[model samples]
Target: GFADGTLRLGHLEVKASVLTHDAVPDGLTKLDNGDSTDGQAVYADTAGGQVRKVAVEAVLGSPQQIAPAGTAVVAADYRLGGTEERPEKSFVTVDATGIGRLSRTESRTNMMTGEVTETLTSSVLPGLPTGVKVTTVIMNTAADMVLVADNTGTLYRYDTHNFNAPVLAETLKPLPEGVTLTGIRFLIGEQSIVLTGSDGSVDVYFRLPRDNAKSSDGYTLIRAHQLEKHRGAVVAIDASQRGKMFVTADDTGEVWLRHSTSEQTLLKLKPADINGHYQAVALSPRENEIFAVTDGGQVYNWDIEADHPETTLKTIFGKVWYEGYPEPTYTWQSSSGTDAFEPKLSLVPLIFGTIKATVYSLLFAIPIALGAAIYTSEFVHPSVRAVVKPVMEMMASLPSVVLGFIAALILAPVVETWIAAVIISIAVVPTAWLISAFLWQLLPGPVALRYGGWPKFALMFAVLFLAANLSIAISPLFERLFFAGNFKAWANGSVGSSLAFTTLLILPAVVGILYFVGERVLPSQIYEIMRSPNRTIAGVADFVRWIITLMVGGIISWVLAGLLIGVGLDPRGGIVDTFVQRNTMIVGFAMGFAVIPIIYTIAEDALNSVPEHLRGASLGCGATQWQTAIRVILPTAMSGVFAAIMVGMGRAVGETMIVVMAAGNTPVMDWNIFNGLRALSANIAVELPEAVKGGTLYRMLFLAALSLFAITFIVNTLAEIVRQKFRKRAAQL
Candidate 1:
């Protein structure tokens, strides 16, 4: 098996040759190929259809071999391809001072006597301390990487095949309690370092991705996993052809099959069955047969056909049975918090947070922005509208980071203090605006004409002033009635779990039935009443409509409240307990502020662009200005309005800095406006830089961006479809 052989498949053929090198007489001297004496070339290989011999070393005199003070352990000659016209090769030797590279060599002959002699030279690469002895070295010449470990249990890595520099170098850190490192092994297919500790503990450190690592940087390990139940010092470790699954032996002669990532013991071999302290362990290249030799000269082969780890659907999508928890639960922990903590990477909560943040931002932004656009575009006098529209448009240019700063620092505190007042303003502001408009409509003709029309500035001031007074008056009433005179106490209260669960199941069905009845039955009956022109009949129809609307609204509120009943939660108290300083309220307001101007500018342009003749014709037909604006102008511009809204949403979804700074960035699943959330954009801003290049986290960040792209594509496509439909409908009109 050690000799060269030939293999064939169809017309293709492969020739395998066992390489060899020069052997000197000194016992301390080493050869590139072990136990081979009839070979001539030490660094010759057929690659890319050419022969390479290290470009021929320059030597003025006979080359001398390096004889170190201590016995050398391992020497490996690697065939490498490179940034050159052909492939090359390099040899490495590990001795007292650690990895000495065999850089150049020469052979000398005395021509007079026709005698020849061969000598090897070496170069001591950088990234190792002086006066240290290297116990083992691995050269990945194909990857241009070198790893060396010293007797003191310190391991170092170089970013070059020449072993000249360190990209990131440090001693093994954060070792477990009362354990000292005893040995190191290149494990998991030469991509990780396995440190064996005195207490039978093995720690696996995956190579960190270098910045320059290109496509498919391979797999990387972030945290170190300590193998379980290792009682004695681990004497040796070996991997199967499948790098993730491996076997380890302790000084006590017990052997265990384990996984490198999960660090779970798969199978065990007892000392009585294996017979001696295992000096070496190896897995067969072609089969699942493991061959182990003990110091007592006993050889044993373990046929492990089913060494693969077991998994099921529950381990992936369903609740996981963790080691210490009493019951299985959904979790999303990524790192090992402690040595005992399992790595859990669930996606449920994160997805929920992303949707929740986006929904809150849109809900807060749309109505206010659309209303403002409508009013400014239709009602305001041209002279005033020009000034107001530009002012609103300027808001789009304000940086999001500045908006986030203000939201987090200035606005959150203000809203938190006037929390009850803020809620009450929802009712008070509209009431005040309606009352002000009524009062203005009742103004005398002479006074209105003197004021250059309806006086929007003064009208808005009256509305705000009255709304502020009404909000302050009702705020205390809300506190006394619903919040027990303490808003914060109410905000923190939780609904009972059993009640929440019952409602979660029952309410949806009830609501669906109600919706079905409303859609199929109530509208048909209402349409009959709406066709009548009699005053009393119309009033009756309006009252019925309001009644249906109120019923639907109340049921929705009840269902939302029922959702608060969750596992171990108390649902008896104030619904407002969910509010927090940097919660969805802050993010919604900040992101909405950042988005509103975009919608306003585009919508205003669309609304204003409606032909003036349409307005004139509606007015001439005895229609009120508001009626004509809504029925004619808005309908004609509906396509543009929808496009405007979609564009605003796009900005909201992609807006990063404001949400990053204002949204507390907690990846929680709850949609309560009082709780903080994490968005995909904000998550990228927060996590992307901390991730290692080409690592899982790094690739996941790109996935998040791709998800954003997909969302934008879907939204835009839908917007276009709706816009086209509205355009057709308007053309018919």
Candidate 2:
């Protein structure tokens, strides 16, 4: 029996003469007594194209007549004619009393005469009840057909050419449920019929001449062997046209391909190996391809009789486009342009907006942060450092939304009017510092030492006081000096004539000239530091003071540049405009303020960690405390300070709330400080929740996340590298 779908029988030692040219079995009869016996059958033509089954006791004797009457004898009736004298022509049909018949036309001729003797029944078929179909059928070497009945247990057979004639075929008992036939195979040289089904169903029939069961109305079906191979539902069945091989597939995607060998011969071939369970299977009608699809929507194809399945020729994504489908074919109107509405995830604008915001924020942030680090770490008094560091660090913890609101609602307005006031602050602070230093030098040396550096501090406070008071004090004075008692009125008179260009525009040119002249000659303190090498108390004070100056100046310049870029250099009259609209300094202010605590904590830690021995050693070498801090302690703690700054940078870059709330979200590419800008963290947080899950927007958000993570990673990595380098440098020293 075949593993799942087929069975085969080999040569059965039947008489050679029984293998005749008559491909169809002529007739069958059942002997009485119901036990099997045998009789003669012939392959012959009948009259006028009708086939005839002539019963011949010429060889095998009828068991019914010889033994008890109940004994059954199988026989076949093959004659020279059926209805008319057409020797070479015949018609055949299977006559099962309880089952339906199968008829076909065939041809026959008298070997002695060259003429057509009869027209035989042609395509012979099996007999079965209506609705009880021939679940399996097979044609033998003699062109005889065998069929398994679906209802009444029966195996019916017929020879070609016995059409519309009386021919009793052997009948077998019905099969049990869950035993649907799969294939019917005939061994050409064996004169046998082999039946196979889905699982554990196999039967074989072998007889010399004709069995008496062929003459009976009912015959017992002998189960030869049962096959128990496949574990699932049989999905497909196929046979080689030559009957040499057959195959079957199961719902589990396993296949059994085998060649047929008679009972004693070996007949087996490997089947195709396609992975996964299959729903439907089809062999390509044009090629050696066998295709199947699984329940999970995957399709596969394999070469016929091949060992393994090949690469997946197609996937679902490719399948969609292969049929000419477009990506992004569907779109919805996402917004109605209100506060409730948000922008779409068009790659261009979101990316631009993100870069613009981050650039502005960083442009605003870096100078102030670095400058503050240098000052607090280098110059500020211990008492001042304590207060300033905590305040700044605490500010870092402030919610960015509040800052954003202030920038949008409060700062933007102040910067606008006092744009000039803010710009002037940049020059005012330094000039004030110079004046303060001049005042400190004028103080008596003994008074300066008794104050223990309070003189320098007092000088700075007075300078700041004077500069700010002076700006307020002289603003009206300058307005009158420049605009003839009514700056706005005068400028409006000149610009209102054309509403185009005015002295307000020309002011930038004047400022540009002043700035070019200023860079050529830096502040006096920088000169003082460059000139002094005494490492004296005054030198340390000068350096710290100048460092603080640079920090404040850097912050102001950064903020001013931002404002000029964000809006313009024009000084509006509104106090709100003076703060926010005056320059891009707002971003610098926001970011710098945001990171101050982090940098302060980190820098102080680094400074505190510096070895006390180094400072003591410097002092023993006649260096003053300030000189020790500047020449020895500062350099020794430099690594820690640099680390603090780097970590603070990472903090600034990753600060989401501050940037999101503070950045304007405008997709502009300007470097202006007065304008608001976006940052990556802020953009991602703002857009992520709104993005559809698993869509382009969602993936893009993921990419942004990856980028942010990467930036932090790189910054931390660099910080570590710098820290290690510093450690190595210190160790060498």
Candidate 3:
């Protein structure tokens, strides 16, 4: 195995064994008699991982002549003891150049004179939560190390640099028998500490130097503010930037605002309203705002500027005047808006937008939905009804974003081009229907049966198609005929207003159409009720039409008035507001279509449930099937239809997504269908993400949510009451 062809491994081993000499200078040793030599010797201990003592001998022959292959020996010119105590009590002995060779025990040494030192003992409190142990210890920015624990409240502090090692640091005992710390915060440039305890109390303290002779604990406890408005354990605390004001919340969901000198109850809630046990509080540094979170997971933000934080309604008495009326002595004005200050989330605009968007949508959809619903439910074959209802209802479930994209992208442009055509069709198509019926009557019986009903459907589509296409094809012609120039320009020139009005001019016509459809679809009960009161069909129709017209008209007018009254209805502003308003087109469609299945299912059931003899008796009285259906079946089913419509209205008013996406996000006061608005749910959804957590915007979103919850609750309550009333009425009949 040797490259040199000399198997020298055993020769060297035998030479080393025979090389024992008499106190010899073997293994390259150097003696320092009375002179000095530069050398080093390293030794390793055979026992464990420790070192107890070391002694050095010298060896020299230039740097290259060291013996034992790698060992170096040098004279020991000086010696120094270790400065600090070691945690282990065991040690190992070493010789020459700091290498251990055997096990030994030694006392700890002092750096200055090499003397023994003793270990110190520290105590820590017990029974803290699991995983809650102290890790960091510090007094303040530059103060001595003090005990700090994880969230579970263990304590740690230290006495000196030697104590700075976490293992050597002392853990502070819990507060004396009568007290426990609930909150802790460093304050006043980190020189003072504030501690909050149970029973609405707080203590301030400052750490003094260890050499201080004043107190045994080397600290002074100062009574800062013992706040008591909180009902239970103070679960949360927050302070303003200057520390001039602080707020606290307790388990009961009560909040208290405390100044350096005094305290005030900020808010308190009933157990049911507390929702979540209060767990956290925060005060905005730059604004007069307070935020609190409860264990139940509800968060609330408050504007602390108000004296009465819990009051929902604030009103002021003011003198008012009305045109052509006696001078007003007093009028109640909402304190929410006064002297250039207004509630940030005013419900007026939002309410208006909700109504407007619903009205507009219904204007567009009711004719389609109700007309479809009526035809499908009343005249269409059973198979066709099955197909048609689901298709329409399926549209309800379509993601609103898709519809919105269509409206903003496809429909908006289409409306812009075919606006006049659409208007003309609405006016012309009905007349065409009447004229076509007259022509059909002139046909022979066989021709009529062959062509009447089926041809009517085809003719209906033909007229509509002609109107729509011709309107678009001849839009310029109509525009020239009506305005003699650009219609938008002419509208702007006449009204001296923005272009939004011109674009929205079709709004009134659309509302008229919605009003017509909605009125025409009035539940049979309403018609029966009117007829039972001796009202003729013409009279009933007129009344219902007037009601629908006014409702739709008022909505449109309110938005227009918004323009007249210094509120602009631009897309960015009014479009959003219109969608947020109540009674919007989407609301109407949702409400109306929602009534479809209910009215059909319930009314059908009620009709079927009626004694067959009643309908047979009406027929026996020589009544036609239509008359029997009207006089007996519908009259008996009146309560169910009423109940169904009421339920549908509640559902429509409360649905979040359709309203949120279709209703505009502006909170405006206009009721115009053409304008935009945000509903309570829509407002919350749109703003929740944009709102900074726990700020006014965030709390406003909550308030909107609460309002929506309340509205839905009230609507359902009212619907139930109305349903009962209708039931009683039907029973009387």
- What overall lDDT goes with each candidate model? 0.63, 0.48, 0.47
Question: Candidate 1's C-alpha lDDT?
Answer: 0.63
Q: What value of lDDT does candidate 2 attain over all alpha carbons?
A: 0.48
lDDT of 1 by residue, 1-733 (tens): 0011111112223333433323222233233443312233223335444323322233333212443433443433343443333223344555443444533333456768857654344565565677667666666535455556665555555555333433433344335655555666655346556667777777766555445443133323334456685777888777756445677888877777876654677778764665668898776664377677898888877887643242223433456534333335544554444432344443445556666766788888888888888888877777778888889989998989999999999999999889889876865686577556545544564675577434657769777987898898888986666566776765565322234323432444565566556757765667667445554464456555545655674566456655545433434332223666888888889889888898888888989988889889999996767779888999999998999989988897787887777778777666577878777788778778777786545665676678778878998999999999998987786
What would the per-residue lDDT of candidate 2 be over residues 542-644, giving only the tens digit for each residue?
5565555555545555555445635744433211121224234565566666666666677667776777777667878876555777667667777877786
Candidate 2 TM-score versus the reference: 0.41
| TM-scores of the models, in the order given | 0.53, 0.41, 0.42
Give candidate 3 regions above 4 Å deviation: 1-312, 315-343, 359-374, 437-460, 470-634, 731-733
lDDT of 3 by residue, 79-196 (tens): 1123346532211111222221111122477789977654323222222334443222224333233334333343433333232222223344334445445666554244435556
Could you tell me which 10 consecutive residues in candidate 3 have the lowest summed lDDT? 6-15
Candidate 3 displacement at residue 602 in angstroms: 5.9
TM-score of 3: 0.42
